[model samples]
Target: MSDTESRLGMPSGAGAWDERSERWLAEGAAGTAGRAGEAASGAEVPRAVPRRGAVDPVKALMHRHRELCERAVDPLEIAAGLEAHGVTDRTAARFRHRDVFSLAEEMFARVPRDGDSQGFPSASPSASASASVGREWGWALWALLPGALCAAAVAGLRLTEGQTRLLVAAAGVLAVGLGLRLALARGPLSRHGAPSAARPATGVWIGWLLGYAALGDGLLRTAATGGPDTLPTGAPDGPWPLATAPLLALALSCAPAAWSARLLAGRARRRLTSSRGLEEFASAVRPLLLGSFALYLGALAALLALCAAVLDEPAGYAPTLALGALLLLARLLTAHGFTHAPAVVLTACASGEAIALAGVFAGRLPGCGFLSVPAEELLDAWGAGSVPALICAAGALTLLIHAGRTLTRASAHAHPTPSP
Candidate 1:
């Protein structure tokens, strides 16, 4: 018998049953035709009854989709496969089911839990489980590499001076970039099945946000102080007001982001498997989502505190923390396949920062004093960083609400592939 037949517990002579059913159907049709002709000819004939029991309606469907049902990891996969093949609730009713999900559940149950038939050799269950656990731990450690690289870079930046500082900074940036690439390649942040279109946009927005944090705030500070009419092309003559602390904090956050995402995805997958319906799944996964978010925030706060202490910067900056939270939430959403909302939120925050800068610059104009009042007052009260903090905090809150709704859905975690 073929692998499919063995896996599905079908007899080697199943084809004979198909032939017999076909013959019965053909004979039944012919009998009906004959009875119609006799009645039309005024010679009444008694109807013939079937000798065998009625064939199950779903049996044919199950045989036709045997491979799909057997290969599915869960009923959801079978349901998705069926829907992709144009099966709907109406189509499911023909097979005596209320919907495609119910039909898929029945099909999944009918298949025997034999060895893996997905063209791979099966291992002992305990061995496979142990290997999976090992890989998870390995990836978790790998995820910390980016943060370590960034921390090393921060230390190098603090130790160097003059032109040598520039070289060390350049090398540090390169090292951190490579570390980020390696860390995200196979860990929880790996981008296996993320939407292709949203990726470029996401990268653009992330760069904008980070770049603004590093240099844009200085420009706004310069403008607010009425120091220059033109934008700064090179380093300022005085002490570099670079807010590297926030940037470093964000970099160090990469590991926490990955861990939180893994925690949420792992727990959500378990919930998906155990829950009987959408409501149950949502209820079980919601707490996991909130807990993961809180865990990430706590980790980010610790990283921020560490960065601030090492760099001798203020640690109470709400904007820095808010930006970190916003970034983590955005990355989490994009990794899970909900990309549009994050992209949009990031864009809005970036625009708000840009507008704040523009308002500062415009306030220097002859008749646009009112345009800069808000920016100047905010700067005077809380410094230029407050602008980004407010903007990012709003964006983060928006994403938190959006995540609460989208991430709780079963469809959001449908594929559950790693993302970068």
Candidate 2:
């Protein structure tokens, strides 16, 4: 096996993740077709029609390469896998230098001329008639989209301010509906297993946006301290949202939120590449994160509702927002791609939170003022917002290290081998 395979093992017995990850980047993950764009669309190879009754020459050629991807870390390993997969000794000798991506490009270029070869039924007369009708309907819809949008905007401009706002909102809804229709029209990306990386991650900050917009103005209004003893950097009282910096910070920090959740919550699975242990562990922990997040949200909502019922004003502004930030930051941490056991990473997160909370209490760390709304003129306790800030600090450090390692490997792949 390749020397890099050993790096898949961690400094300790984190299992063989080091070897797994090394294999992942070296030639892409096993049993994974690269992204659709990278596969058929991106390749610059010649597209040639297959001969009648002929084998898919390209697919036949790639069979051994895919088989070798399982346990082949080095030339010797690949040769062994190739032989075991029924490649003649002469054939194996000729393929010793073949790169995986090059082989895939060739496979992409091969177009099976018959429907049976590509596993599609031949078009019947009725099916052909329906396809033509569908084509006409598509062109008609395409022609109507822009005109409808212009009419909506024109109608909105002639309405009263309040009515205009409603009209604009309706138009926005229509636009989203149109976008969804177009995306669905594109069909699925691929037929077989798409590698984990092939899946696109959406941002989950929309929920945060809705929550912040609904309560933000009140949250900031309640947090303003008139006391002279207040720190110079503390949030000043105003109708406008508190410090704009936190908004930007949260936006960037939570950009990866959805992606992380997908990884932790078992949304993405590396079927061919990752070990069974890693997969099972990920599958198990995902539910814990999901259930934890759900329970936290339910409790937070109920607490806020209770506060509203008891107090006349925005009562849960401080603790509710603080805890909400903590929940999101914690979810983000779970997606941090720990190489070893999930337990070790979870431990680090818990310890880091404790240490960070201590630092904040001692005035060693800056506060997340935007999220830390105050119940009174002053807060005597370190607000729970410190948990998220501290968690973010730790996650940022680890992510930086991961990025550096990735860059180093890319440099090696570009030139020679990287340093271990």
Candidate 3:
């Protein structure tokens, strides 16, 4: 055996097979084909070898395929590669499936815990994994940058212009697109064949894009009516003064969060042993829930603090509070399914409707706006027309339950044993 093969745990004579077994397989195969083809063709037709893509089948067997499959390399592909490269394995031919699998088991065992060798197992698994991790973190920062800027814009710069808000959202979209491309191009996440079907199809993406565009247009139209720096009268004029700025920042932020989740989930799926994968995933749910809560609360508190400092009007505090609360709820809830379209639509629509209802009440409250009214009057009015309040309460409770369950799972993972 070659030093490389021995190191890979490949048997000393994997290429050897019993002469009798080889003859038997060859004879049997020809006869079987001959019998099967008798009704269609007078003689057996020769098989055509496939050398799909640019890589030679021989070289692919030597290297790349192992990387593609990770440690779970396929035995049949090995058998075919051997046949295509004119190396014979009597054990592989006679057993057809068994011997190749036996070889795969040995090769998989020989595979270095960290990819180190060039032939039997991938030479770059560790490097590829490290690269993937680096890219994920880099993309996370890509997501963080825009969100931080948007939050700052809302708090200090005063995000009042519709076009500027669109531009921010566009930058987020661009980052998400670039990160996704980088993830798919090299190492760790790829498949030997086509992409995984678990992700949404192109049509689904198109539909989502169309829906988001329509939502953006409606928001733009709403802002246009106000004609910049003006309010819809009684609507909160502080903290996201244009009313749609929070929504725009939120919509933009979803791309990064979703991208990160998709990458993390995919990594977990690809890397973890099936036995412990679900358990680990459940553990992660709590951290995600906590992070989402922290993000919402932190952003709201910071923005509210800035509004108090910058606006310098006590009256400005109330509207800012109302706006901040609604946006916070929407952001926290929608984050649960940010990686998926259907979930995004459902969470967004539900939260958006609830917040819009609050806006409606504000627009039509007696004497003064609902948000502008005193707390006692607002509570009394809520008591008088309590159906909407009930709906909002139910939705909020549902989301709370989800968050609580996620936290529980996280806590379970964190404290697997009781304290003494």
Candidate 4:
């Protein structure tokens, strides 16, 4: 019998082989006389048979390869298969001259094109639909942005002097809104399995929100320092409202960013914990650098705006403005992409406060001596006005020092001392 038939215990003949086997079995049972007769007649003893089927060798190899790649099984069988096929002399030889996992990935990557023959789904219109929806949502966010600005402009016209009571009332409302958001955020987050990265992102987002709040708070403090008469002062007055309005809007916008950071940080932390120590530290540093760059750019924009308003020759300021703006935006985008660090948070806050100071100084400086009020009154106004600017400057300096320390520490880690 052939090797396959012998192994399977099956007759290697037509369907009539069953009858022949039965006859042989009968003949073999006839004892010594029959044994002598059988030897003369060239008869053979019979046995029960088993079923067999052809198993596709390639498909089995692919399945086993997948199992090994997924770490679901030992790779010994796969190695044996390769050796059996003479694909390599040694069972220890690498398959396809590549890591099993990498080979598996490549193999599966091409499977979709095989149209289900390789057990992969073909590309479909659903993917295109998702892409379309994402595009629409992105465009929609910016579509009504101008309308919101217009509304803020119209509202500013009515918020003139003697509206100090109204301004205080607005502050009260903002405080309440923020408080509600905080209270709501507390419940879910307290029980969350959120990751460490999320914490930093949360810190960064909170920092950004705080930065905007700091800007508005600084402006309010500056306005308050001017007394009731100093109302409607600063930055096209309309633009000031725009700036302030965006703070609330930005605070709300930060929610999504914070949540995203939390999810990402958690994933990153898990991945890093399993990795080499150096790689883990490098991963964390990426976000800090990114956040730092963003804060820098935003600060730069505010500075340029102040320069444009306050300087005599503003023509040459455009390039500086553009560069600063790009840098700030780049910083934000990069920080958001990577792991957020506390340093980036502090950096952003400091940059924002500095920009705000520039704005306040721009609006208040020249007018210091040119007020319609008496010279003595002008001196008093300068003294009062300087209070807010000084506070802002102090805050900016604090944040800058904090961020600087973090950056320095990070730098130190990146360049460890060598042992003699």
Candidate 5:
């Protein structure tokens, strides 16, 4: 049957469609088949209406900018996508040209409620520590240069001045440098750097004196016995122990001083916690008190023992021994005072120097039997001559201690609120 007849009608005894209806149906079917084929090929698919400039130009620029940003930012994208509509090209570029950190923050802020796509990155601890240590070392080196130069000058002078003057100057410079370094390291009294204030200055001073005595003794012995090159200094039988006896006596005298300092340290810590300004002044002095007592005890015992041991020698040596002990004590006390109790340390220091001068005067007195010179007369003469000196020393110490205290109070008043 023709296509039109098949579509139109069915014949009797064998089904057939009418020709006109079949032709109309065939045309409709052909049209549908053409459309279906076009749809399958995407030619007849519906197109989404394009809104004029709907895609942000800033976002396009940022995407392009990543080519540069990617080189710098390894694991993270530095530039962020711009979403605002009316921003100028320049403004948008500036916003996109931020660091990875800024970009990350911007992205985080923009993507509110987005899971796991926002927040600041973790800091690199190792890198940060390295940077901090590097900076600290740089500053430390700069500060140390002056002290190092002073030390070098003193050390180099030994050949020119003979050992005595050179040694004295070197020791003085060393002590001063140490004091300065310690002060700087501690910082202003308002902000001391050390954690353990419980360590009394008095105790520290005693220890320092003992140690210094040992060292000085060893050096003197080395010089006296043989050239330092051939000497075995580290041996226990070394000159240090022998030299340290007088220092030990002085130290023993200062034993009670250390305990007193410990008490002072406790008080200071309490005051400091309350944001008191006098923390440093009090802390510095408290230690000195304890150290003074210790020094006194150590020095007395060491000196007496030494005197007994060397009794066979001329009795005059007793006074000389006393003089030497006084000198070491004076020096150690001077250093400690400068560090922690500038006034008291200085007064103690001056007294020691006076004692040394008296010994010198006695030694030089014409026809004055050096040992025969009564100890009392010697002391009286020194007191009479050194009266003004003693007064000046005492006054200076008093002023320093007083000023330090006043300054602390003033600081406390200035910063009423404690720093976090």
Candidate 6:
């Protein structure tokens, strides 16, 4: 066996090392000898000499896939290409890597990024990601449409009365829904391929959360405080008791949510290209993730304040802000293909809200006042909005923790196969 093959533990055979690699290694050795002779002759060598007996196992693989690595935008793409060609985590071990991703990353790092040598203009990773994000900026603008529609509907609701108000509100909700669908259709939030089974369940839970916020919360509060056990139809002289602040805040938040998601995705792709290891990538991305989330929350808070001012409602309710944050985080996770956690968290939050309302009603039964006591105390201490706030805050916290772990992985951002 040749020295390089022996060091790499490859058995002597034609399959072990290709002729091209042998020639390349021979040329490299000759070049190294020439450099050493020049150094011996007192001519300065610009680069240090590699150790005499050292051999990089990945060098051959890197050389073999030079074109692939040079053209790749990120390590994930290289990993995907390697995977497509029958490379697995087990195969990666042959190159002294933990997995194909690690092997691909090493190869990507070794390859020169200069496109001039490859006879083509290559965009820098950051520039390419930014260009891609700029192309989709329309989604952010579209996101504003839903909020505008809802705000106009709220204005119409205030100006109308009785059946007319209800009609306006229903029409506003429909328009907002359709606008939201359009906004998410082509952005980072767009879902690819066959919808998962959990999608229907996610929609149902989302509907429940919104419905409860709009009406169930008020009814539950009224009943807990000893008001009549009845739904509030729109009073002719006043606006409907719908929680417009949360709805308005959430709707207005679509723009920031889309922007934040795009920002994070672009930054993450750039980080993937620059990060040297998985741990490095995670460390770098965690801060970007937190920053994007915080930016969204700040934007949501500003919108909530505006809504409260225009609607003449209290702006201090934690539930609305919590729900907005929860929804944004859930959407962000889902956008990145982490669907299960968001669905599970949303369901849990919805169930919690339902159970709280149910328990309050159950307490209304004779001798069952204990069930009502706890909920009533919470409402009395923090107001009725506290129920959804506490539940949604807990759910948001859970999703944030889950996202920190799952979204940091390289595989989460990779699209290895075409969606059917």
Residue 318's lDDT in candidate 4: 28
Residues 1-420 of candidate 1: C-alpha lDDT, one tens digit per residue: 443223223233345445655765577567678778999999968755432123555655665665555556678766645554567678887776666678778878765544545334667999989988997787777777877887887777678777887788789878977777676666676643222334676677777888787777777877777666554433434423566777788888888888888889888877766665555666888889889988988888898898788778766458777888898788777666567889899989988888888887777789988998888888899887788888999999999999888788765565531111
Off by over 4 Å in 1: 1-71, 79-103, 110-116, 121-134, 192-198, 228-240, 415-420
Could you tell which candidate, 1 or 6, scores higher by TM-score? 1
Candidate 2 stretches with Cα past 4 Å from truth are 1-94, 102-116, 123-205, 210-222, 225-420
lDDT per residue as tens, model 2, 157-242: 33434455546745744663453234223212111111112111121232333234233433433333322243322122423322
Give the alpha carbon lDDT tens digit for every residue of 40-112 in model 3.
8666555533322232233234343343223223333333233323333444344232334344434445333
- Looking at model 1, report the run of 10 residues with the lowest lDDT sum: 4-13
User: Which runs in model 4 stand beyond 4 Å of their true positions?
Assistant: 1-134, 137-158, 163-337, 342-344, 347-420
**What lDDT tens digits, residue by residue, belong to model 6 across residues 1-420?**
322222222223343225545665787778778888999999988875332212656776665555455555566777745654567678887777777777887777766543533344556999979976875666667778878887888788889877888799899888887787677665665543222223878878987998887776677767776765444675432223567777888888888887888788879878877765566777898999999999988888898898888788767557877887788888877766668889889999999888888888899799988887777888889888888889999999999999898777655555423211
lDDT of 6 at 366: 91
Q: Which stretches of candidate 3 lie over 4 Å from their true place?
A: 1-130, 148-300, 311-420
Clashes, model 4: 7
> Candidate 2 overall Cα lDDT vs. reference?
0.35
**Compared with the true structure, what per-residue lDDT tens digits does model 4 show for residues 1-420?**
332112212223333333543444455445445446766887784432211112323323443333221221122223322322333322212333333223333334422121322232445689968966774454334323433443343244335544563574355445534443342233111112111123444444444443333244335445435523444343334323323333333323333333333343344444333332223434564565455445443544454454334332222222233322322232233332222343454455446545544444445567653332332242356532243334334434444344333332211221111111
By lDDT, the candidates rank as 6, 1, 3, 5, 4, 2
Would you list the clashing residue pairs of candidate 6?
none
Model 5: residues with Cα > 4 Å off, grouped in runs: 1-184, 187-341, 344-348, 354-363, 367-420
| Residue-level lDDT for 37 in candidate 1 | 95
Cα-lDDT of candidate 3 = 0.38
- Per-model clash counts, in order, read 6, 5, 0, 7, 54, 0
For candidate 4, list the clashing residue pairs, or say none: 197-265, 198-262, 287-339, 293-331, 294-331, 294-332, 297-328
Model 4, TM vs. native: 0.29
Better of 3 and 4 by lDDT: 3
The per-model lDDT (C-alpha) reads 0.72, 0.35, 0.38, 0.36, 0.36, 0.72
**What lDDT does candidate 3 reach at residue 194?**
18
How high is the lDDT of residue 308 in model 3?
44
